[model samples]
Structure formats: structure tokens, C-alpha cells
Target: MFKVVICDDERIIREGLKQIIPWGDYHFNTIYTAKDGVEALSLIQQHQPELVITDIRMPRKNGVDLLNDIAHLDCNVIILSSYDDFEYMKAGIQHHVLDYLLKPVDHAQLKLF
Candidate 1:
């Protein structure tokens, strides 16, 4: 089963995702959630999850910075952003992020994994 780590500053978004995703159905067993990138990094180091889903504008080490810090690490990153901007998308692409999703995440799109 795949392990996944999810990070977002907003408690609601993080909680919503945890509640919404049917991880077992997607062959994922472990799901870790963090409120910020700093906390998320610790979990990432310990869990080394197969995938990471994070909000781009989080406080204290945003998603892009976290992605850069882990650029050499072997993990798939899926960035979630509220706005559609080239800067964020460009950075995500440069870091070889697996995918980017906008706010109010679409279940259909996520299921396509």
C-alpha cells in the first residue's frame, strides 16, 4: 500500500481532505496530515511517503520551498493552489512535481491517480 502525506495551513482543508479521500480504495494505507511545511517535513523524513499533497501558500516553509528542499528525495508531489499562476506552476514543473490541483479539489481528478 502506498503512503501519503498531506499538508495545508488551513485546518479545514486538511481535515476535509483526510475525510474525503478513500485512501484504501486507491491502494494507500497510511495517511499523514500536517498543518505547515515545517511539521510536514518532519513527517516526510520519518514516513518517506510515496506521495505528498500540499497547499502552495502555507506558512513557515511554503510548498514550493518544501519541494525544493526535497527535490533530491524520491517522492511524488502534488501541489494544491487556490490561484492559477505561472510562477507556482513553473516552480512545480521545475521540481518535477507529479501534478497540481486548484482549491476545492476535484474528487474525479484525484481518483485518476
Candidate 2:
């Protein structure tokens, strides 16, 4: 089973994702959630999830910094952001992020991965 970690500053977003995703159908069993990048990092270290979906602009660490810190780890990353500009997208691409989703996340889009 694939393990997944989801991190976002907004409580609603985090809860929404947890409720919406049909994790078991996608071979994902363990799901972890956090409110900030710092907390996410701690969960990542402990869980070593196969995938990490995190918000780009979050308190304490941000998605980019967390990705950089875990660059050597064997985990795929999905970045979530309200910004759809080239700069953030470029950075995510450069870092080889698995995917990026804009705010007000689309369940269909997320399930594509």
C-alpha cells in the first residue's frame, strides 16, 4: 500500500482532501495530514510516505524548502498553490515535483495521479 502525506495551512482544505480522496482505491492506505511545512516535515520523517502533497505557501517552511530538504529521499511530491504563475510552476518543474494543483483543489485532477 502506498502511504501519502498531505500538508496545508488551511484547516478546511486539509479536511476536505481527507474526506474527498478515495485513498484505498488508489493503493494508498496510510494518510497523514499536517497544517504547516514544519509539521509536515516531522510527519514525513516518521512516515516516509510514498507521496507528499503540500501547499506551496505555508507557514514555517513552505513546499519548496521542504522539497529541497527531502530531495534525496525517494518520495514523489505534489505541490498545491493558489498562484498559477510561471515562476512557481517553473520552480516545481525544476524540482521535479510530481504534480501541482491550484487552490480549491479539484478532486478529479488530484485522482489523475
| Poorest lDDT segment (10 consecutive residues) of candidate 1 | 104-113
User: Which residue pairs of candidate 1 clash?
Assistant: none
Top candidate on TM-score is: 1
Q: What lDDT score belongs to each candidate, Candidate 1 first?
A: 0.87, 0.87
Clashes of each: 0, 0
The per-residue C-alpha lDDT of model 2 at residue 6 equals: 88
Tell me the tens digit of each residue's lDDT in model 2 across 1-113: 89989899998988888889888888898889999989999999999999999998888998888888888899888888898978778878988888888987777788435
- Among the numbered candidates, top lDDT falls to 1
Q: How close is every model to the real structure, measured as TM-score?
A: 0.94, 0.93
Error at 69, model 1, angstroms? 0.9
